[model samples]
Target: MTFRHAADPVAVTADNWIHTSVLVLNASYEALDEIAADRAVVLIIGGAAEAIADRESYFAIRSTRVEVPLPQTIRLRRYVYIEHVPHGGDQSRATLAGVLRRDRHRCGYCAGWARTVDHIRPRSRGGPNTWDNLVACCVACNTAKADHTPEEVGMRLLWQPKAPTHRAKQQRKIWRQLAAGHA
Candidate 1:
């Protein structure tokens, strides 16, 4: 079923409110991870968790016997032990969107708004798509630097490209449970 979630001036009609995100917190008020709305509701109903913060807009989900306010944040009654997992290393393969996000969509050559990724080493010369070799480039710079290294074209990189830092450990998952395929 759908829910009318007023995002702003535009009302976003989501296909499934059950899939909406709810922040899950440990008993000590430590943020754990995001979980599905349905699971959060189950936790609240089963007395495993309680709603710490309700949705900004007053909305209630009703059952035959109870009406629980939809939550933006929920806290568990018992502390959950979560372990950190290594997200990725510096040598990880890079994608176009990832490159743009890493560089904030600014041209590596001119620091202008960018929408394309350029290879420091041209692909024709066997440059693999890796984080350290890719940088965001604007249309003009990309076209001008076509098939040529920046030095050969007298252009300079604004910053050295590198893989993005990993997210905080707790945001990933329970390492042991995930490794054993139980989480």
Candidate 2:
């Protein structure tokens, strides 16, 4: 509810609210991103966005001029243009965690749960740490294919690997809806 400060009744401590996540929506009510609660409050107080939903239990953020409820979801007052940026292209460096997430934690060789990543062209032979060269692998598969290319071990990949696509299509659809302003 209302939090009062000992020194100044109008000031609320930001420390407690900094970790809370607030969902952000576009002007057209399309989901965009999640940001910290403090940032959401700033956007709301600055008149850049309005709170669409508040936390069930109210947490008051008090300032000299105003006191506002902490927001759970906020929508921008105006549409914000988003440019799609490609992530981790073939030549770009790939992290072990990123490769695992891209493969859905499934082994690319046997479709089993994976805990590690394997280089398609073994790192020993100078495989670059790129999206196309890495795949999620189970312990057994990684051991079996150690320091060797898939073909050398007579192993076949379940699927070809590539860089993950961004949310370009969904963003485009949201832009179209914003333009139409359909009821």
- Total clashing pairs in model 2: 0
Q: Global lDDT for candidate 2?
A: 0.78
lDDT, candidate 1, at 28: 92
- At residue 24, candidate 1 shows an lDDT of 82
* Model 2 ranges with Cα > 4 A deviation: 1-25, 28-83, 86-92, 168-183
Model 1 C-alpha lDDT per residue in residues 137-182, reported as the tens digit of each score = 9999999999999999999999999887554223333333333442
- Tens-digit per-residue lDDT, 1-183, candidate 2: 333222333333466566677788988898897766777787788787899988766789887899989887999888876655555343336889878878989999999999999999988899988888899999999999999999999999999988755553344454455445422
Model 1 accuracy (lDDT, Cα): 0.76
What TM-score would every model get versus the actual structure? 0.49, 0.49
In model 2, state the lDDT of residue 26.
85
Off by over 4 Å in 1: 1-83, 87-91, 168-183
The per-residue C-alpha lDDT of model 2 at residue 105 equals: 99
Note the residue pairs that clash in candidate 1: none
Q: Which pairs of residues collide in model 2?
A: none
